[model samples]
Target chain A: MANAVLTVRGIVRSFGAFRAVDEVNLDIIEGEIHALIGPNGAGKTTFFNLLTGSLPLTEGEIRLRGEVISGLPMDEIARRGIVRSYQISSIFPDFTALANVRFALQRKRGANFDFWRSERSLESLHGRALELLDELGLVEWADVRAGDLPYGRKRALEIATTLALDPQILLLDEPTSGMGREDIGRVVDLIRKVSKGRTVVMVEHNLSVVEGLCNNVTVLARGRVIASGSYKDVASNEKVVEAYLGAAHA
Target chain B: MAGTAFLKTTRTAGVSQSQFLGFTKARAIFFLLFAALIAVGPQFLYPIFLIKVYCFIIFACGYNLLLGYTGLMSFGHAAFFGMGAYLCGYAATQWGLPFELSVLAGTVIAAAMGLVFGWIAIRRTGLYFAMITLALAQMVYFIAMQAPFTGGENGIQSIPRGTVLGFIDLSSNTTLYWVISVIVLAAVAFYNRIIHSPFGQVLRAVRNNPERAKSLGYNVDRFKLAAFTISAAMAGFAASLKTITFGIATLTDVSYVISTEVVLINLVGGIGTIFGPVVGSFFILSLEHFLAPYGPWVLLIQGIVFTVFVLLFRQGIVGELQKRFRTHL
Candidate 1:
């Protein structure tokens, strides 16, 4: 068994009486595409929120490399090599594509608080940002404002931003939630290329996407994991079929 | 990363992909233009009037830092501004400190005050933040009204413009104009440099989305406090310079009107743009000058302008111009 990069044990999140995430346990191992598949409102977002430290866990232990990270702030957790991309493409809209990536690169390089040096002089940081942009096929549009980008491109930028963290583990919320057929293929290719040696856990609804991209799959039904394993193993599970794959079977 | 690039191209393809206003170039040009204008302006215009404009411009710009970059609207900016004027006025008139030293003193005190007030005020957000700041400024106003040294109703009358460096007599309005202009220009330049810096970028990010910024490995609160301190100090600097020019400090400095005026200036010009405060100051000051004979007409005109712009031009003057021109900064 590969070493677990992140472990979530008995995690529960409740909005008053409504349990957004029931006592769910997950161990995402290093260097594997683990897809958290579920129906709409299966608490996928809330679970991702808890994992990324966006929302606090009610009663659970989340460990990154066996270190407790539940009580830490989102930024602190991100700094420790675990980062998540947003579903809504949260980026500095006014900033150039290169500048947005530069910002992410700046954080990873450290020393942004320094008031002395001109930010433009951070040459290495700029170079790294440029390289990352090139890798993402955004080199031509590096100078373009992020806000002006199309929906598909913005989603891609969101992923690129997460990659800038140089994260050992990545939590992606609906990486291809909104994309045209061509863009979806492009995103799948990008994900496959980028996921090499990096641990990726994503919450996606597209079954074909799950079947194609995910090496391991966990089915979340009403905030609980009904079945989890390889795609073929979970596809045959009757409980998962009734709870999540009802429309797929139909 | 590839996704962002594709998005950028597709997005820019729809619109003209020409670079928007480069913030760095715009900032440098703005400070340079102002410095040139102020340096040469007093040669033609009334020196005392120019000095007044300088003071208010600095005051508005300081207010802009809080509202524009940090996304925190303060209704009580006049409180800190007035406090600075009062402190500088008192130090120069009573304690016999050098004009520059008194201004520095005022700035330091204002910064300390900002730290305390910002800590308290920033605890709340949105409308509550505005109310808290206003209430705090009102407290300062009341204190200024009752304090014995503040000269109560009459205020500190006949405050000496004092000898600059205890040598050159500033009794000449022209000489004092130059002095005040230099201070204002410097303050504006400093603000420009700050906004263009990395710190400023982080501030804008924090303003846009505090939670997201925090998640991206930034300490949001620390940035907020730092920005608050810097803004307050700059305001104090402007206030001290104003005292030097006018030779008096009054309750008028801390009045609610001063606070509202600063916000209006920012609103008229453009809240986030570097040139917004300067442009807004000139327009408002010129309006006030033109309407001197009309009394309440100035208020009426200002109110109309505020309403029209708030409803019609959400981006303010400079922001709208940038949008139209497709400049990126």
Candidate 2:
């Protein structure tokens, strides 16, 4: 197996008396696409949030290549090359698809505080931004305001922007969520294409997408991992089956 | 990389686009003539009146920078504006500093205030941000009322406009108007450049979706704070220009009433459009000036205009024009 790119150890996030993410331990292997699947409120999303540093870890630590990264701010984590896509499509609605990708590219060139200077440097980022759009099959929607794009195209644009960051490890939170079956296939293909040469950890609800694209499958239930292995191994696990289908169906 | 096909619709041939007004050679020349007309405005109109209008235009523009562009609504803009006036007045009348130094001092101090207020205010979003700014500005108002250097209720009067470069007398209204016009025009140009700059694009990203911005490796709060500082300093610069020109720094400059007026100026002109606040300033000020003969009915008329705008013309005049014409301005 590839070396562990990210290691999570007994991480806990508690709100008052409730533990949204409790004692979650995960190992995300490099150069692999890992699927995190669970029922509603299984803490999969919360766990992703903790990895990206969006939520503070209450009792454990996350390490990138064995170095601690849990308590850093979201932006700092991103700067360190751990980038994520939201469960809901998140792009700058008022900006065009091209502009959205260009803004994401701003991370490569420093986003400094110099209002007096012209943003002429941004013009340099245009070429790469368009390339990402083309790769996402969003070239036809490039000039369209992101808010006006069709749902599938908007989702494509969001992924394009995420790709613009050129992250070492990408976290996709339900990349195919709300997508039509046809669009889901397209996104799965897109994710497969982009997952090369880097690690990807996805919290996916669709098991078929997981089975088709992921190198490993980790099943979660009620804030705990029930099973983790190859798709076939996890599929046959009694606990994963019980958690997914309920005890009666299992 | 913007999908080449759809980008064609938003950006057509021979039409450049930007956050502010985008123009071609013909339009650029037309704008030049327009500037010439405003420069020679004192020839046909009262120089001080035009100066007053220009100053308010800058103030409104400054207010719009934070609200329209960055989507930050601040009701306490009066604090920066008023303090700039008071500081410039104090530096000029009390310390006998040069006009340039006095203006600089005011701008820097107001920017510093912006840093503090923005650091605190940006910790909250939307309504909370507005309220925090309002509360902070009210505190500034109270301080202005009680400050001993501010001449209590009367304010600082007879602030000499002083000579430019220690030679050309600013006492002459025409020369003063010309000097002030040069400065105001430059400030406006700077303002235009800022909104079209790279920082502005990042600011819009922050305004558009701060969460996404943060996840994209942008320190969102830092951008917000930077935008706020620049905006506050610009407001201070406008206030100083007005105080130095009018020869007085009054309590009215710092009052909440002025703060609300700045908001009205933006609302009527167009919130985020290039000429929105500029046109709004001239229009609203003229309304107040020329319509005073109608007594209390003038206020009633103003109320009607505002209500009509809020209900039907929410984008304001320039935003509407920009949308209809598909132009940047």
After superposition, which runs of candidate 2 have C-alpha atoms over 4 Å from their true positions? B1-37, B293-298
Q: Which residue runs does candidate 1 get wrong by more than 4 Å?
A: A114-117, A122-124, A246-250, B1-33, B163-168, B323-329
Q: What lDDT tens digits, residue by residue, belong to model 2 across residues B1-329?
A: 44454554453211255323333443354356558868678778888988998899888878888888898999888999999999999999989999889988888888999999999999999999999999999999999999998887999999999888899888999888888887767666777767767788888788889999999989989988988898899889889989999988888988888888888889998998767887788888889888989888877888888998999999988778778877656
**Cα deviation of B16, candidate 2, in Å:** 1.7
Contacts from the true interface found in each model, as a fraction, amount to 0.31, 0.68
Q: Per-residue alpha-carbon lDDT of model 1 for B1-329, expressed as tens digits?
A: 44543453344212233322323454555567777888788678777777888888887877787799989988887777888888888888889888778888788878888898899988888899999989998999999999998898888766677777789788888778777777777677667656756777677778877876776778777788788888888778788888777878899988999889888899999999877888888888889997899999888999999999899987788788778866632
Candidate 1 at A21: error in angstroms? Answer: 0.7
What does the interface RMSD come to for each candidate? 5.8, 3.8
DockQ of each: 0.30, 0.57
Candidate 2's TM-score on the B chain: 0.91
Task: For residue A221, give model 1's deviation from the true position in Å.
Answer: 1.6
TM-score of 2: 0.94
lDDT of 1 at A216: 96
- Against the true structure, whose TM-score is highest? 2
Q: What is the TM-score of chain A in candidate 1?
A: 0.94
